[model samples]
Target: MFQSILSNLAIILLGHLLMSTLITYRERFSKHLLYIYTVVLFSTVSITMLYLPISFGDYRLDLSLIPLIFLALFRGWKITVPVLFIVSAWHFFMGSDETLSSIVFVLILPTIFTLLLYERKIPTNINLKILFIITACWIISDLPIILFIPNGMEIFKNTFLLRYISFLSVASIYCAFILIGYKNDRLKQRLEFLASHDPLTNLLNRNKFIEIVEVKMKESDTNHYIALLDIDHFKQLNDTHGHLTGDSVLKEISSIFNKYESDNLKVARYGGEEFIIYLKTVYDKQAVRTLEHIQNEIRTTPFHSNNGGSLHVTVSIGLAKFESGSRLYDVIHQADNHLYSAKNENRDQLVVSFD
Candidate 1:
């Protein structure tokens, strides 16, 4: 009995590990592919549990409800139904005369009851919720034995009744704790990402950009440049068109800059109607060519308005080189000075030098 308990635990822990790993790296998969992998995983775990039931006098108790409750709670009907079908079909193949009824009591009914708990249809404390669901599923699990086996009631009352709860309750609570840990871990990752990224453009925010620049300044062996850009007559354009159109213009402009992003180049929406581009290069000429491409692309690409008409816009750019050992803000200040010059003198110009 101890060995059987150990074997069941090993299987359950392995299944949890696979699920946690998938959730951690879920972004690497397409949504459909992730769904397929999840179905296969839970179905495999449930089927494996059926084959490893811990034996009593006349009945074997498999930890089927653990996986069923988890799948129904987390995944919903779409995923649970398919998993149930697969598990039931495999149970039928195991050649029980009571297979059809076992499906009703063991897997399906418990899953539905657990899912109702998931929906929070009734208000209950968390402990009570867990207790109620586990107790109900436990009762359902005993139904097949009581109905189909001879002297089953005496066997169940004497051997299986008390021991089953201790195992299932401990295992269920342990699994719940693991899932709660996974949820918190994923939440922390999401918060970190949201902190570093701009909600509007999904680009690196100003502070994150600054952090990266500081790291790059310390490590970069080649020359570095900052290209500060502002949309020409942006306020007037916003006043002429609506804010929605203005938002569209900003989104389109951000999309244009996103195309030029690479290992050596990064871009950020610095503030309203302004952007910053950071570049690392061996040659000053290479830096200027990249800036020119970006400027020309923004100038020529037609932006869309809410009224379905197209609008043309241009960016005034100020390029400044980062001299070794100079403060980052000092370089940014020079770029701003040049930007002021570009804005004053012309609507669309790339100012690349002190001259």
Candidate 2:
């Protein structure tokens, strides 16, 4: 029994390490961690079958409850039911007699019921109701063995009691681990998002925009167009109102851009009141038309202030198509120059040039 336990523990550790590595490779940590735990639990069951003694008179403890709890915590009831069924099959195949097999099946039924009560969210507390139901199921699943044993009541009093305690201890530990992992995963995601996005407008920041633009430019055909847009008299707006009002206006304009922009158009908050849009197309006229439409939309929409007042804002845009032998920076500078010219000439117009 001691050797069997050690071997199972070793298997669990090895499986955990392997699955953790696989999880690290995934983009999302929450799903990865759940999958890792499931793999480890299944590996533990397989290892136990190899090393553990299963005889007619011997009462073998089932470790399948761990996976059910994990499934419930991570994937909810839908996954737990199927996992329970698999565990039951594994138990029957590992030399468990018909009586023990029936008992295992019976015990798994309550787990199904317990799982049904699980919401997709991990419970803040270990659910006492579910725990009690699980205990009851385990007892019921062992009923056949309990009934047919030579000293049936004595076997239930000693063996089943110990098994129940062990199961609960393991489950509690698993739940704690899962919760910690969940919190850590959420924190990491939040940090990553903040690093990539502007806090005020919730749009991609200049740094992230440069990274994306570089990649796109390297892979892009020569026909793409790059546009720079500047909010006309943005500093004046801040001077007239407060910085807070200016921020609100920026946010409002960002929302409009997000709503109207297509997947092929990459928009970013490129420092202060300046924004950049990269349109992946050969048609310079289409890109100019798109910017004109955005300018028109902004002009028509009245930005309401907290003081029950309203203001109209306009944007000056300059666009240039990508040249075959030119650098990305060169394209951006050309667009910025044109934007400066637009601001000097017509504050709310778009100027498009391929040359």
Best by lDDT: 1
Residue-wise C-alpha lDDT for candidate 1, range 1-355, written one tens digit per residue = 6667677777777888898788888899999999999899989988887777777644577776678776776567888888888888888888477788888888888888877667523234655666667777878877877787788787777876555764575467555767586568868888998999887787888899888888888756798888899999999899999888888888899898889999789888899889888899999999989989989998899899999999999999999999867788888888888888889887698887633
lDDT scores of the candidates, listed in order: 0.81, 0.69
Q: Write one digit per residue (lDDT tens) for candidate 2, span 306-347.
A: 576999999999998777877888989999998988998968
Candidate No. with top TM-score:
2
Measured on C-alpha atoms, candidate 1 has an lDDT of 0.81
* TM-score of candidate 2 against the unseen true structure: 0.75
Model 2, residue 76: distance off in Å is 6.0
Query: Could you report the Cα RMSD, in angstroms, for every candidate shown?
Result: 9.7, 4.8
